[model samples]
Target: MKYFVTVQATQADYEAMEGTESPGPPRWSREELLAMVNFMGELNNELAASGELLDAQGFTAPAEARFVTASPGTEPVITDRPYAAADVQPAGYWLLECVDLDRVTEIAARITQCPTPPGSPEHPVVIRPIGEAPAP
Candidate 1:
């Protein structure tokens, strides 16, 4: 089965990574950031070798996000601003094809162990099964 494992973060988290002063956690040192990058690369390689990783991607900061809302007959409303920092946003995701829920859950557990600066919040890692599409 296929699953999407998502990692959440707040605006403050993004700011911390950028070495900016936001109401979030303390900034990450350059070495810490490099460690995180390396960690993720290693994890991805391991998953790919096992033929479990289908895809993975990280998102930009929430502040750079664009929002759009519309109804069938109404014009689309658009804005550049994102919700408040307290609201958690999806920071990245991994698409995986695993043997079963247990396997995917194991992968998610590993994802939750990804490196972060000390004292940083333990962000959530959500796993959702992908449903089959209806035949056209």
Candidate 2:
């Protein structure tokens, strides 16, 4: 079965940011960021070798977000401004074809080892099963 595993962050952290997007990258050193990137690459390689990795990627900064809200019998309200940072946002995700949820949970746990801002150790990952489409 296919699963979606993504890094999740709290609204509080985003609210504390100087910007809505990527937090400006000023929170970590270049070397530290490079190390995290390398670590992610290693994890992706492992998944690829296992033939479980369907896709893996990070989302663009939240600053580019667009909101479309429509009420009953009303035209949709569209806005390009960043949506509420109080809501949890996905930072990135890995799409994997795993045998079951247990394996997917393991993968998410491993992903927790990825470094975050200094003194902050609460970045979490969420995993959800991608169900099949309805038959025609």
Candidate 3:
């Protein structure tokens, strides 16, 4: 089965990773950021070698996101802002083909262990199975 796994982070977290000064969370050092990049690279390589990684991508800041809504017989309302306020937003995702839910869950567990600042709050990792369309 194919699964979509999401990793979330707060705006402060993103800023910290970029070596920017934020209000609350401490900023990350150059070495710390490099460590995270290396970890992700290793993980991606491992998954690709195992033939489980279907696709993976990281998104830009939430401020760059756009939301759209429409009503009947009306033009769509498109805005560059988020539709709802959120403390945590999806920072990246991985689409993986796994043997079962257990396998996917294990992968997500590993993601939760990714390197981060000491005492950083743990963000939830969402994993959902992809549904298949009926045969055409």
Candidate 4:
């Protein structure tokens, strides 16, 4: 089966990207961010070499986000990001082909261990199986 693993951050966490307390810049140090990126790259490389990584990517900040409601008769309400009211949003995702959900969950758990801001608690990684195309 193929699974999508999503990394999520709460609004608070997203806000912290620019600073938590009265701040001027991101809280994470350059070295810290670099290390995390390197670790992630290594993991991705490992998965790719094993041919299990179908796709993976990190998303831009919500500041660039735009939401459109597609409900009928509801004038397409469009909202740009800096979504201060959002409870949670995806930060990154990985598509993996695996034999079982257990393995997928284990991978998600490991990904959650990637270093986050200092003093930050464990964030979340959502995993779900992708729908397969019907056999013709």
Ranking according to TM-score, highest score first: 1, 3, 4, 2
The top-ranked prediction according to lDDT is 1
The C-alpha stretches of model 3 lying farther than 4 A from their native spots are 82-86
What is the TM-score of candidate 2? 0.77
Screening candidate 3 with a backbone cut-off below 3 angstroms (N, C-alpha, C), the clashing residue pairs are none
**Residue-wise lDDT of candidate 1 within 67-120, one digit each (tens)?**
899999999999997678777899999999999999999888988887887789
* Per-residue lDDT over 21-136 for candidate 3, one digit per residue giving the tens place of the 0 to 100 score: 76656688988888888898899999999999999999887877889999999999999874232368998999999999999999999888788877666789999999999999
User: For candidate 3, what is the TM-score?
Assistant: 0.91
**Steric overlap count per candidate:** 0, 0, 0, 0
The model with the greater lDDT, 2 or 4, is 4
lDDT tens digits, residues 1-136, model 4? Answer: 9999999765555556545542422466667677778889998998899888999998877666788886887778898746663456788899999889998888887897787666764657899899978999
lDDT for model 3: 0.85
Q: What are the C-alpha RMSDs, in order, of all predicted structures?
A: 1.3, 4.1, 1.9, 3.2
Q: What TM-score would each prediction reach against the true structure?
A: 0.94, 0.77, 0.91, 0.81
